[model samples]
Target: MTWRFALVIQPAGVDDDRRDFSATFRTIDPAEPALSVGELSTQRGDGIFESIGVVDGHPQEVAAHLDRLAHSAEICDLPAPNLEQWRQAVARAAEHGERRGEGVIKLILSRGVEHGPAPTAWVTASAAADFTVPRTQGIRVVTLDRGYASDVPDRAPWLLLGAKTLSYAVNMAAIREAKARGADDAIFVTSDGYVLEAPTASLILKFGDRFTTPAPTGGILRGTTQQSLFDHLREEGYETAEELIPVDLLARADAAWLVSSVRLAAPVTAIDDTRIELDSGLTQAFNRYLLTPRD
Candidate 1:
């Protein structure tokens, strides 16, 4: 397969077969050009976005992912994106990538690329590389001292805690530091000592006879897989609960796992130098169910 070129073109409404380059003109020179004035000033106006994984031609829990995007948009004070329209855009982006057998989809909506402080909106979808295997090996993670930074506590600045947003500089920095320190991922805990979350996913623990994860109110992003696991566990005679787990609790738990759209459910085999002495019996039980999802 010889690679040719990647072109970013055809907004949602464009005629795909017409090959009309005239209507779909480029503003900033793809090679080098200055961003428009509005882009510079209105970058933070208001927007909603989403990222979903297309595996074996399947968009894993796409509906759940969009619900989260809409929830995050509302939290960010952004205009609600048309749900069905966005869905189609993701499908198109996934299809555009020939490797639809397995890949990632990124959907972004920001203030319209036009000028002024207007509440305009735009959407862009693109293919992404797949990196789902490493997450299964159980990523090495580090804990951060700062409980996620927030502007106003009353607004529950941590509301964005779980919402996946483009504003992820801090999370990236944390991951960078972790990699610098030869670790795989990072975790942050609230000052009160409750385990907050991983840089990009929700945290959970597998204790005796139970599957425990933090509740949304715990300032953690609502995890779709974790929710599925709850349903999965309940049917298998296992109990699930959301508790304010002490950040340090992970270090003491029987076993720890990071749950998200990509990883699904990955065990934290270790925390720092602390070897997670897991009670595999429970994991074996869950694995049986996971291997053949009821869905």
Candidate 2:
């Protein structure tokens, strides 16, 4: 896997490095030591992250992602991040990887070391592989129980249900289980049968001319990509909503999708073993909508 580290170089004699803007990039050596054992994020999943889709050097939905990242930090009780620093890093990474046409800019923030007050932050850029098979051909998904009720987030703040934390063991495991079962991905449903979200993406359902997704209060991470697409759809005169949706309703819906930053919008062709209807035209339209540069 090729990786590039974004480096920000301050101008000579610039006391306030925050305002400086010269970006430098270097290839990251995989064999080099990148982290210490004592880092809290390495010792424990004590961090938050954001994966921004980069197209031709520009990061889509920059402000929205930063806002979400800030919200994640607040939820994790970490110090307020230097937003300017993150922006610079992302810009540097994007510039470095622009030649690839499309890629991902990953921003991470950790709670410093095990015994420190500072925080660890960095950005990495890599060319995104074409997931056209899933996006164009659609994907088969299995429904897995998230082992938590829909009301868990409202009742228990310590669980960090709504926050986009770095602890993705369960999510990855669920995907692995699905793959083992001969499926492409997994959709996490609540213990009570409410459809939640995919391991790394949000779920959206379409019925006739209406569109809806699970409410964010249901212990699901608020999806930035979904929200961006929703805004675009609403402006185009489509009926959009966010409400609690039962898993069974997916079978009756006109169509369904698994959307994310990098993957954009992918049609869900099957849930478990049952195949659902796929609107090839609508899916293509959604792909165009999502990939279109947002202003």
Candidate 3:
């Protein structure tokens, strides 16, 4: 990805005076090195992040992304991010880009350097990858065991399963494992046999006129894109829901998709070796709505 803009943020406490809020952001060269070697984000992946899709220079779903960022911070015991400060930062970062076509804005808040006095924060804007083929032609996925039960989130809070932390090594490994097995992506399933989510995206399955995603309760990051699409689907007179999904149900679904911020909505053409019929009309409608600018 080619970064077009970068800004280092001086995060403010919730109670801090905001009269000089603009001063909290400093523009920087995206190609330059601006982080310390001992930063916890680099050393231990101790941080939280959010990727907001940008369409024609407008950052989509700012409020939802910010809310998730705060939720992740709370889960990780990191200091609460002043939403107002981050909000302005996102707008500023978006302005520096070419403001055309599709792009993305990523917000990051780290635990900072080991033994340091404060946290580290920044934002970067860059052009998004071309996902036309995946969005139009669809992708094939394989299921991998996540090595835990569906109730693991409630049973083990210390694992930080629901937070969108910087610790994505395992998720990346899962995708690589899928590719090695002749698949495009991987869907994580509980050891006890329940559907979870894709490594970096939320899984949505359609049965007749009803659509369902794995309930967000079990360590799955609440997908902002999926939530928005659900609203759109509901308005179009389709039923949408979040519920526990059994692994065997993948074969029974009429259609399915793996949705995320940058990739938008990608239809799942197959699971393991089982073929799924792609709903071309619905997929096009979904991307048409997503490509439009939304606050």
> How close is every model to the real structure, measured as TM-score?
0.74, 0.91, 0.98
Give candidate 2 regions above 4 Å deviation.
Answer: 1-3, 6-18, 21-31
Ranking by lDDT: 3, 2, 1
Tell me the tens digit of each residue's lDDT in model 2 across 1-295: 3545544222122133546444432335434676678878878889898999987667888878888888888889987766666776677777666554678888878886788757776667787778798998899999999999887888888888877888888999999999999998999999999989999999999998999999888388889999998998899899999998898888888888999999888898998868878889988988887777764
RMSD of 3: 1.2
Whole-model lDDT values for every prediction: 0.59, 0.81, 0.93
lDDT of 2 at 163: 78
Estimate the lDDT of model 3: 0.93
Cα lDDT for residue 47, candidate 1:
52
Per-residue alpha-carbon lDDT of candidate 1 for residues 214-277, written as tens digits (9 for 90 to 100): 6566266777767877887788788889877776677777778776655455667777777775
Model 3 weakest 10-residue run by lDDT:
14-23
Ranking of all candidate structures by their TM-score, best first: 3, 2, 1
Candidate 3 TM-score versus the reference: 0.98
Q: Candidate 3: list runs displaced more than 4 Å.
A: 1-3, 17-20
Q: Looking at candidate 1, what is the lDDT of residue 171? A: 77
Backbone clash count, each prediction separately? 3, 0, 0
Candidate 1 vs candidate 3: which has greater TM-score? 3
